[model samples]
Target: MTERDFDEIAALALKHTGIVLGRHKANMVYGRIARRLRQTGYRNFADYLEYLKDNFRDESTNFINLITTNLTSFYRESHHFDFLRDTVIPELKKKSDKKVRIWSSGCSIGQEAYTIAFTLAEAHMASAFDVKILATDLDSNVVSTGAEGVYPADSLMSVPDDAVEKFFEKNRTGNQVRVKKSIRDLVHFKRLNLLEGWPMKGKFDVIFCRNVVIYFNRETQKTLFNRYADYLPVGGYLIIGHSESLNGLTDRFKSLGNTIYQKIY
Candidate 1:
């Protein structure tokens, strides 16, 4: 792709998704766009760009899904789940409402959300307390997949055998497993653009926006962080990715180490 071509595509991505696609991502972007070209029956980048501009109303979703990265796995960041089990749940148990809400913002394909469900199930929360996990992503494709709650059998390699048996049922092919109804019921998957307005009416007890802000600029990060703060009450939790930090961005939260932050003000 020419420099001009990459610039236009990057600009369009930023406009729609608030994701920064620096020149360094040119090759990766080119590859994904090529897949789009093949799917859309376009002959070249320039032609695809022209078609995209005219058909944006119909194609913008595909463009955004192509540009956005969705890299996630069950217990991908195990420590976060550990903290949820060891700290967050116990704290919630003490509350009188007996209701718990956790959001997996930018949740790719529901692994993280399902992992939270597994933790809750292990703790007997399904029968003892009211629980809900909202798993949302910008990619509608992944959102649908998450709602199906089926995954490759090998994806559970990191999970212990007993837990896997308890949480998922092996399909006839044995190559895939579907999350058990009891576990899948805890999560609700939807397509959401973080840059757009959120429709959720209630504050989440914990928000897992892991690895999502790394694609946004500092200014966007600042806006998004404060927006998250607005959705959380004081002492509510915000858990981010391993590589992200809130320092110099916002002071609404106090770092509790391990990339966990508690809303303090």
Candidate 2:
């Protein structure tokens, strides 16, 4: 891929999805999207760029799918689940509405959402309330995979061992596992571009937006953090990626440590 071609692709990704791609990401971008060149029979990135200009609809979706990083697993950053099981769920249970509403923003491949599902199940919170999880990502491919609820059986290892039998059923191949219908029913996966207006209605009690904003610039992060605050009511919680912080980003939330925050009116 030529440097000029790479620059064009980078610009397209940012324009469509709000994911910032710095010079350092050039190599990673090339590695991720080279398969597109091969599949489309384009001899080089230059040829692919020409096609992308005319086929932006089909190509951009595939481009974003290929370029965006989607590294996620069940109960990734496990302690967050501990807090949910031990603290958050119990508190939400006592509320007058008897509802549990969670938004797993950037819920790649559904493991994080499933982990939320299993944790709520273990706490006996899944069926008791009108529970719902909104799992969204800009990439439609990952959203489809998440909604399908199938994964390598070994991914079950990321959560408590007991959770495997409770929430997932093995595929006929026995090498793969799919989330049980009960758990799957709890999550609703959709295609969402965070930079665009959200179509969702109503507030969320707890939002898990981990590892999603590291690719965005500060201004974008600030806007997003503020939007998150709007989606949450006073005392609602927001869980971010361990590497991310809200320090100096916004004052809408109070730090509860370990990258957790609570809305403070």
Candidate 3:
């Protein structure tokens, strides 16, 4: 693809999703979009670019999905879940009503959200707690896959045997495992562009936005973190990727170790 074409698409992505692909990302863009070009029988990036400019609604959506990264898995950053089960939930139980609202922002493939559901079910027992997990992603493809709640057996390797037996069913046709309806029902999945205005209502007790903001520019990161603080109640938890830090970002939250932050009232 030409540099101009790269710039155009990158700008459109940034404008729509707050993801900044630097000049060095041109090759990355080429690699990701090239396959789409071939699959659609377009001769080159230029043709694909023209198609995008024409703004066929479905094509545009696919183009955006092509560029967004959706690498995620269940129990990723296990320590965060440990913290949730040990520290965060215990604190929330005291302050919250029976209903606990958690947002898995940038949730990919539903694993993170499902992990939360599983944790809550195990902790509360009998599914008596009014727990709700809202999982959202910028990529519609990943969101759809997450809503399906099926996975390869290998993906469940880290999950405990008892939990697996309780939460998944083996597909006779294949080696896949489908998440039990009870667990799937605990999560609500939606396509959400974080850079856009949020349509969600109500403050959350916890927001897990792991490994997502590393791709955004510093200004975007600051804005996103502030918005997370806004959506959280006082003493609410914000858990980010282990590699991420709020250093030099904002002072709205107090560091609580383990990459966790608490919003001060």
Among all candidates shown, the one with the greatest TM-score: 1
TM-scores of the candidates in the order shown: 0.98, 0.97, 0.94
In model 1, state the lDDT of residue 165. 80
Question: What is the Å distance of residue 122 in model 2 from its true position?
Answer: 0.8
Instruction: Give the number of the best model, judged by lDDT.
Output: 1
How accurate locally, in lDDT, is each candidate?
0.93, 0.90, 0.88
lDDT (tens digit, per residue) of candidate 2 on 160-264: 668887887897889998888999999999999999999988999999999999988899999999999999999999999999999999999999988999999
Q: Assess candidate 1 and give its TM-score to the true structure.
A: 0.98
Model 3: per-residue Cα lDDT at residue 104: 98
In model 3, what are the clashing residue pairs, if there are any?
Answer: none
**What overall lDDT, based on C-alpha atoms, would model 1 receive against the true structure?**
0.93
lDDT order of candidates, best first?
Answer: 1, 2, 3
Task: Please give, for residues 1-265, the per-residue lDDT of candidate 1 as tens digits.
Answer: 7899999999999988989999999999999999999998998999999989999999999999999899889987899999999998999889799989999999998898999999989988888989999999999999998999999998998887888989999999899999999899999999999999899999999999999999999999999999999988899999999999999999999999999999998
Better of 2 and 3 by TM-score: 2
Off by over 4 Å in 3: none
How well is each residue in 1-265 modelled by candidate 3, as lDDT tens digits?
A: 8888888889888887788899898888889899898889999888888888787575867888987888888888999999989987777667546778899999989999999988888887326567789999989998998999989988998888998888899999768999999889989999998988899889998999999998888999999999999999888899999889998998999999889999985
